[model samples]
Target: MKSSKPIAGRYLGYREADRAAPYARFFNPELAPLAPHVCAALDRGGVPDILLPDIDQATTNLFGGEAVLEDGFVLTSDGGMRVSVRSAMPSVTPAMVDWWFGWHGDAASKYKLWHPQAHVHVGWRETPPAGASGRVLYVGQTSIVDEYIGSDLIRGAIRFVPPATLGFTDKSLDDDQQATIICAQIGLGDAPIDIGYLAHHVRAVPGGSEMRSRFWMGGRHVAGRNLIGGMAAVVAKRVLSVTESDARALLVHCAQEMPHLASFLPELFGEFKDAE
Candidate 1:
């Protein structure tokens, strides 16, 4: 929101936006009014309850494709936080979700299209290997991005992984047909240490698809690259743990980005899925 792109600093100003891309219509260059549902979800509050970092059981709830804590943030008892946001995406599919994730990381322009106001820049480490397509293009790749969770600018690494890696044992998950869940390990910048986990579960619905996004930030998932880093993380954990404000910010970010993405994802995918 400050400058449309990051202007300076370590993780900022890496890439500039391509204003003349064919995907321009796929997203707005500005923010629109929050949808009514989004407003309501932000109004109501969520508290951390039974699903306290127990992702195996929580993944079961997600597979059902029903609304469970449909929206809002939960401050976990373990000094971590969880954010839940469900977006109803009309005419969007699980395959499109996969394609979008894989395709967007290729350029900062495409990444900005997901959330113009919040997203600043993005770069891919190793993506779309030879002979890899669809979900394969991104499932094993890592994307480094500079974006805003709320008012704070964050530079983080998102490493996509298979559902089995996160304990989503549903038999139908092997393919991205009926449902597609994008799971990732979240880290601070390019560091080898992982600090969080996230899953965006896009399940088939009657009209289109619904994405149930979940984030588990901090808690036992936080780790370091080595023994020295581990000690640093321990000290940092006691001093600067995730809080309610962090959860609320993440909830708002997810709530905004997904719907904006679904708005034009179908058309975007249809046009560029094969070529791009």
Candidate 2:
């Protein structure tokens, strides 16, 4: 290599002496000849591991070195490892790394635009038409009233449903009886189902008044605008993580009470046939 300046000449001058020493030892005179060039290379952009001193001692203790040096290459106690100085760069902003690892990117991305679809209960002031139970399955658009109901459920839209009244005497609405009633309501319908209803919450939001109230059933929740979708999404994610095919197949079973949705389950989940 051509010498760039007096600094490079110094390394070239010792080239012959460094050549005489063992290549593996740090003090090898032959290799010492290239130390300056190595330093220069590191200044430009090189792995500091090469420039680390006392290979024998530093290798044993990455952190146990001359007390004078606050930071430089790191050596493990066993003397078998060496690390570059770049590892310290993370101290500048720890949160950046934390955010990258901590955020649920995959889950958030799936439902940010719309909550995941999950099952929901719908009740009529009057009983669903006799033998018309299958039509009860429906999918609805996202709405705050639905979301609010999903949160606590007691003070929200569910109150108008039978599960809130006939099913539960506690008035809390979370009682087992109420939940069973709700589950039964979900069972009444099938997939690819749509229904219309008056939206009580939309009028409060600007431009919401113009939007008609309707529900569509297939993917998940009956209420579109509520947290119910989020809850269902979480469950689905968990199930899919373990067994994609099994999860998709089990979703088909969700339509037991609602045969309409179940009838089309084969089509909706057919794509996952090879998930295993």
Candidate 3:
């Protein structure tokens, strides 16, 4: 097997701002295949897990487990075998999510992918615009429009976000510098996107008190109640019946569980939200 050092470097490159292109970035160079093996082990009726130390050693954590390598071991428990890796687990992207569930066996097909569909931020611009007018632009996923046209019977009716409303820049960066790079790896970057705080709508006043950006994932960002927050948003849609505060709570929890799920949470959740 390839050494973990090279793999870690690859990860860093993928997470960087400049190389963080959707579908173009690396998802799981060495660990993706393990998903199927782990799933197969779990089918035997025990908790199964995989632990990756850096990019090299992979530890198999199981309910009634065994040692897989010198640097790795499996932990077995009643709830399930806790798979702990000395190294950090890569964040799940849309493509990775699909692969994990798709190959996990027959039981995984019903599982729903989860992540924040849309994120919105609101705050005041204490400083003036860097250039001309403050920009407001939207990034959209092609699938969204395709699905819209497919179900709505609308042709040439699709709307596009003007460049003025969105900030479009291409730059390469390291994982420490940008998290969006990770999002692009697994294909979630293509979501219907809209960024920047709006000044005035049809009837809304031009207020500068709050500068915000909202995120919409399309379906649920979470799978079910069991997996709340990002996961729920990925798989299910937000319910009007639920209060915004509660919905946010779910998001907070999701961020806590999967720090790499999205890149902007550091700004959204404050400094602590940024995890290695």
User: Which candidate should be chosen as best, given TM-score against the real structure?
Assistant: 1
Candidates in order, TM-scores: namely 0.87, 0.14, 0.19
C-alpha RMSD of candidate 2 = 32.7
TM-score for candidate 2: 0.14
Winner by lDDT between candidate 3 and candidate 1? 1
What would the per-residue lDDT of candidate 2 be over residues 54-149, giving only the tens digit for each residue? 323322223234442212222223222222221111111222221211111112221111111221222232332211212222112111111111
Structural RMSD, model 1: 3.6
lDDT per residue as tens, model 3, 3-67: 11121212121224423432222222222122332334333332222331211121111111565
Per-residue lDDT for 105-152 in model 1, tens only? Answer: 977778888887888778887665634443337877889988988878
lDDT of each: 0.75, 0.22, 0.21
Off by over 4 Å in 1: 1-17, 35-37, 51-53, 64-67, 132-136
TM match of model 1 to true structure: 0.87
Query: Which regions in candidate 3 have their CA more than 4 angstroms from the true location?
Result: 1-165, 168-170, 173-244, 256-276
- Candidate 2 ranges with C-alpha deviation above 4 Å: 1-81, 87-92, 104-276
